[model samples]
Target chain A: MTEVLSGLPAALGVESLLAMLAGTLAGIAVGAIPGLTATLAMALLLPFTYTMDPLQSLGMMAGIYNGAMYGGAIPAILARIPGTPSAVATVFDGFPLAQSGRAKFALHVALVSSAAGSFLSAVALMLLAPPLVEFALQFGPAEYFWVAVFGLTSVSLLLAGAPAKGLASALIGIAIGLVGMDMITGAERLVFGVRHVAGGIDLAVLLTGLFAVPPALAMLSATGKHAEGLGMTGPGIKVRQALGFARTWLRSGLIGVTVGVMPGAGGNFAGILGYSEEKRAARDDSMFGKGDPRGVAASECANNADNASSLIPTLALGVPGNSVAALMMGAMLIQGLNPGPALFSQHGDVVYGFMWQMLFTALLMLTLGFAGAKVFVHMLRIPSALLAPMILVVCLLGTYASTNSLGDIWLMLAFGGLAFMLSRAGYPIAPIVLGAILGPMAESSFRQALLISQGDPLRFVSSPISVVLVIAIVTVATLPLGRILWRRLRARDARRAEHPPPLRKDR
Target chain B: MSTPPYHGAQVGAGERLLVHAAVAALGGAVLWDSFSQQGASAYFPTAIGCGLILLSAVSALKVVPRRLLTSEATLVKGLGGLALLAVFALLAGEAGFLSTALLFIPAMALLGGDRNVPRVALATVSFVALAYVVFHVVFAQSFPPEFILGGR
Candidate 1:
């Protein structure tokens, strides 16, 4: 407690606080844009932090992390396009609220919930991180290998609807990860004599291309079709309304934080679960699909809270909780910080500074989001024709800036084309990105563990941590499948009962 | 929801088979390369390749399967856009930033179904000029010189 209190002053210096505010503002702007995410914003700003104090640097990044999560809600609410994948589930009710002349109320709900969610998660992180780190310290290479495999399996199985497609995407991602020099043998696997390929694909560049550019291109392709109607502009909800929403959706916020801490369960899942739970709990359930402030509040709060708590596992265990968190971990690595228990011990000041900054950043997000509500809503008025071109330019510039290589631009175009097709065919893009991100790490760790154990398969089960991870992985993967099967069976039974099936047809 | 009429259009079973065969061949190549590597390198890629092949086969086997070739117009547009992108990449090393971007952006936009060719061309030119000023002049970043037109 003394150590924590003593560290607070250095962490909360005026300069650091100011930086955090600025970063939060910038993160919100970047994240509100359809193609930009928190990870991209962090990666872009990382180079600028090279010369700053570690605490100040982390302050800015932390602010971005919290603010971007909130920023994603902007596009989700207005355009039915989620600015970040975490906001994907928000669009279900958020856009409908906007369409029903409750845009201001929706924005208010999102902003308030986001702030509340971040606050809750920041508290959780501060309270739980040390113990989590202590527990994480017991992991070995075999354990890490299993953890990575488990993360990949759970993410692929649950997140992507088609198991086969998800596995394929994961495999492709691993293949991409194999593009650079081999870690153990020092052999170039698939460089094809290209020096840039030898360095391997940057996760930042891959993400910018895979997630950002393709969607922008897709938008451009469909730009001729205009978005109909105007978003609402009014005084929004009164204090009493907002407070009522907060009181009603408090449990959803808790669920969000809990789900966020769980590996592989992301904001999308949290938002859906929260929305359903809130609807079920509502005294008047019919108000849910309408412009219900509580409905939006529940989803927005859970998603944002989930986003913050998702970082807990990544920071403590060095195992990313989701794709966005994985990208954050990648950014940390790019900044020369090794994630895990050592990160907390070696960079306690920086890590704690980040925790403190997140609280202030959440406050800043609330202020800016509420104050600038009109400005953000007005962004929806821009014609898709003009917006599409600008998005393309940003995508090109972002891709180029990451590597300064035109090759990356070509790679982006190719992937963009492939992604556009996949999306059109009803295959989800998120799992592919997750697979790509987790693929190499899992493969390398698995191989290393096997080699260390002289190719013994039982080595994984021998370790307590690995056994626990395997069990967790199995439970996560199987539970979802079981639930899905049960739902199908129930649906079949319902149809049979309703139709009185075969007897009538035979008669 | 009723299936769209475009769903049952001209892609036949043979073409679908060919596409899956091509994907399988790609997987095979990857698998062969993976096996050539030392230690467990083979396992990862081989697993991935096999999975890809399996998925591609499953997809191919579905009746009225989702084929790569959707419509003649869409196919032409996609191929044309891909070809233009390839040309742009090839020309990037030789053409100056302004010339390449001015030509490429409008062409790609046009292929993307924008009918206002002249407006797209103008916008592309304006954007390229702005980009050049920002990146080369203001930002002091070096770019490829106009080799085709000699010096700039």
Candidate 2:
């Protein structure tokens, strides 16, 4: 702890701190806009970091990750549109809360949860990285595959209206994930010989399309004379009730850290899982589908929790947990720092500086989210007519900036159209994005596990870790059916008690 | 998740039937496509496709058609907006982001039914200026070829 804190003063030096602040504010702006994403924000900034001291660059990227994760909730609350893919579930409750003019309270809850999640995860990274990474390293490919499936099943069962539609949407995402060159055979599987297929479909492009495009279209769907403003005012519950805060934050934060430490599972899974669980556990679940503060807290906290723990596998095992961590790993390499066990011995100061940076960045997100709440609430004043177009412009530009590729722009539009369709049919889009993110990881891991076992099917169940993961997945997947059956049995008992089954005319 | 207020083209009975059939057909296509591939690549997608087919058939039979229908007007307008975006993509690379955005913003506002000239004008000018400061000034990056200024 002392070592980490000692390194923090150096990062607090003027230039590095300014870089962090500037990066975070820019990230907030990018994230508040529909179609832009944290990954795209990080990718765009990666080049700029080449010129800075590695510590300074790492701090800025860390700030951006936390900043953007919180920023996405703004539009999710205001426009029923997710500014980032991770914010997709945030819209479930956040926007509904906003619709009834509780936007400020929801935003406040999101900010608080994001900070709590990030801070705790940062602390975990500081104190427990070695042991946690050691445990995480036990996960073989089979385990990784099962872990993703478990995450996917939990969220799928929690889908509100139609489970089959959720599954179909997930299949669409996996199909999209199958595009581009085969990682194993080096042959084209789905791409129709297009030059762009080799690079594959960019997640940012798909996310921007799936999330950003639909809301703008929804605005145009309105035929009425345009309203001058959103009619929003006042903060809705600035501070959450004490009990709700503790339970929601703890549950979601744990889910976030657990999922974040796993390589390739990513924060969206954590956010979705958190949201689904909170939705399930809420006493007044009618509010769960409506605007519930717990929803924002769960998803926001869980996503930000990934901010710190996602670095665990990256720093300790030399395996990037997700793409943002991949960029951070790239920065480490640029600084002539190698990850893995030797990294601790060789660059303890720099690693601790990174941890302190995560802690400080979470604090910054809280401060900024607090001060900026009222100002951002003013975004509702932008006329509905003009607001939609402005968002459209931002989305198009952000998607283009994500990669200099025009094909990505095309993919964004196509997915945007797809989002419009799926959403109309009342299908949830979160599962689709989750499936896309997890699809490659699951498939590659499954295949690789099989290959390692020389095509032995039993090998998947042989390892203890894999066995536990398989059991977890099966149990979680069957839980909804079990609950349904249990409810039916109770209902039958209630009915029998009410009628005595019978004043049965025969009796 | 709560559904967005996205009214797209309403699916009539005939169209709904066709749409469901089309979904099944697409699944079949994926299934057939996966079957042709050898070894590992075939497995995941084939499972997904076959599942999609079964799900689609079951959804068509069990779920009401009303759940599948979206608003026609919204659908047409949204797809139309996408066409406008495609135009921006085609032009932005050559014309410069500032110039392309200036044209694109007002055009979309109009498409979205905004006729307030002052508001449209204000948005165009402000967005351009903001993009200038954010992209060109602070980042010191090039969003170059100011169409009005000619590759500045």
Q: Give the alpha-carbon lDDT of every model.
A: 0.68, 0.72
Q: Tens digits of per-residue lDDT for model 2 on A202-267?
A: 665666676557766666765424312232444555443624698888889899998887644667
lDDT by residue for model 1 (A343-363), tens:
888877766666777677888
Please give each candidate's TM-score.
0.82, 0.71
Query: Whose lDDT is greatest here?
Result: 2
Q: Which sections of candidate 1 miss by over 4 Å?
A: A1-103, A192-195, A223-232, A238-240, A421-428, A477-484, A499-507, B1-23, B62-84, B96-99, B103-142, B145-151
| Candidate 2 per-residue lDDT over residues B1-152, each given as its tens digit | 22333334564444445545666776787787787678998998799889889877766775564534553236567777878878887887788767888888888878877788997899789988887777667766545366774455
Docking class of 1: incorrect
Can you write out model 1's per-residue Cα lDDT over B31-147, one digit (the tens) per residue?
777776886766777787777788767655653644443322243444465566567657766775456666667666655556676777667767777776766677655555755
Looking at model 2 chain A, report the run of 10 residues with the lowest lDDT sum. Answer: A224-233
In order, the candidates keep a fraction of the true contacts of 0.15, 0.40
Please tell me which predicted candidate would have the highest TM-score against the true structure.
Answer: 1
- CAPRI tier of model 2: acceptable
